[model samples]
Target: MISAVFWDFGGVFTGSPFHLDDYARSLGTTNERLLEHVFGRYEANGDHPWHRLERGEGTLAEALEAADESCRADGIEGFSAEGFFKAMSGTSSEERRDKVMAKVSELNDAAIRQAIITNNAKEFGDIWRSLIPVDELFEAVIDSSAVGIRKPDSAIYRLALERLEVSRPETSVFLDDFEPNVAAARNLGMHGILVGEDIVPALRELDRILGNDGV
Candidate 1:
């Protein structure tokens, strides 16, 4: 019996606010090369500045300075990490997805636990936090910056399960837009749902997995 539901913020909750291609275009470089320059070899999980920033080891300004230097070394002349993040933040829509929130409310009413698991930047916490009613809709909000660990890491998943008081992974369902994150959750024995452009199908699938449409 699934007793808990885990949600990913950013892409899963709202329209994706950042695009590599768009960022690359703005910087006059190819997406692959730009990503290599900014994210280093491991991208999300490596010892790069981005990873450091997400883990709360450094300030946003320090990370931006590092990225700016990297861009300069790559011949991108004048790249500003602050500008990049500002543009990325601008892409978010203020309108919440009523349908998904309604489903969340239904699940809450069913007495199933819900929590948010996000690998997000520390500075953007207020912006993303405002997008949802954390107190009313979720029982826990585990953020990578606050916890010092991100998704695709088993420890974070374990942390969420622990906080949710779920002793077995099978008693929970996880939803994320990123395939790697979803796969990681599945590996830990939780039923994983990949939320894409349209969330209705995924929510419906979750409802089915929980054995009730009312959920």
Candidate 2:
């Protein structure tokens, strides 16, 4: 029996506040160029400045300075994290998905625990938390910045499980928009669900795993 369900925050609970391509276009640059200049690639791991910020090893100002330097080194000047994040955040509104929250409520009503594990920057905690009724919706909210560990790292998952008091990984279901994070959970013996643009099917799969076809 599945006793717990873990969720990802940015894409799963809410629409991605920042669309990289859109933001890049607004800045008169291509997503490829922006990513190359800022993050060095589309999917960066622990070594990236973004990851460092998420892991609480550095401040946003420092990360932005590093990004600016990287952009300058690539011969692409005028990179501003402040302007980008501000515009992106402005475009983002607190539009919670009712269906997903309803499913979470159903699971909670069934005595199944639900938690949130997200790779988020330390500075955005208040903004992100305001997007959802986090205290009522989840038993635990594990932000990477607060814990000093980000997703795709098994240690964070283990910490979440430990905090939830779930000993058997098999009895838990993990959902994330990122494949790497899902894979990491599976590696630790938990069932992993990949949430795509449409979350209904993923929720259905989770419901089926919980043996509730009607849910």
Candidate 3:
């Protein structure tokens, strides 16, 4: 039986992390430019700045300043982490994720251990906790920044399995909005779901997997 349910934070919980189109528009450029400027280059294909931000390594402002420095080095001007973060934060107002958050709370029980496995910068947990009592809702939370590894990397997924104490990958269900991350979890032998608006079926699908797992 599925012993655990691992959730991704960004698109799955809220919406996509900073719309690419919005970033592009704000920068007076195309989506490709925004992608190239902020995320196209990285060491070891890792999310360095975001990882640091999520792990509590620095504040949003601090990350922004560092990004600005990087921009200066690259001879690019006017890129705004503050603006980007503001856009990403976009009013934590909508009730779009209420159902899913409530679902997590509803499923809070011993039969199933729940966790959040997300690629976030430092302070992400703090921000999420402030938005909701995440500690109360989840048995564990594996933030990439804290772990020094992000999703699509097998090690981080293994970390989630370890924290949940579930030795068998088949005993877990991983949910994320990104196809690559979902694929990575499946490769690790865990059931993976690509979250979207129509997720009732996915929840039921999870129940089926859990049922089979003997939980």
Off by over 4 Å in 3: 41-44, 51-77, 91-93, 197-215
CA RMSD of each candidate after superposition:
2.6, 2.8, 3.5
After superposition, the stretches of candidate 2 with alpha carbons farther than 4 Å from their true spots are: 17-19, 27-33, 36-45, 86-96, 212-215
Give the clashing pairs for model 1. Answer: none
Which pairs clash inside model 3? Answer: 1-213, 1-214, 53-121, 53-122, 54-120, 54-121, 54-122, 55-121, 55-122, 56-122
| Per-residue lDDT of model 1, residues 68-102, tens digit only | 88888878965776667665565555444666788
Model 2 scores a C-alpha lDDT of 0.79
Model 3 is weakest, by summed lDDT over 10 consecutive residues, at 39-48
As for TM-score, the candidate ahead, 2 or 3, is: 2
Q: Model 3, 136-198: lDDT tens per residue?
A: 889888987788777778888999999989899977889887778889999999999887645
Q: lDDT of model 2 at residue 100? A: 79
Candidate 1 deviant stretches above 4 angstroms: 41-44, 94-96, 212-215
- What range of 10 consecutive residues in model 2 has the weakest lDDT sum? 87-96
Across 139-209, the per-residue lDDT of candidate 2 in tens digits comes to 99889899999888899999999989999999999998778889999999999998876777888788788
> Could you give me the TM-score of model 1 versus the true structure?
0.85
Residue-level lDDT for 128 in candidate 2: 78
- Give per-model TM-scores: 0.85, 0.84, 0.78
Ordered list by TM-score, greatest first: 1, 2, 3
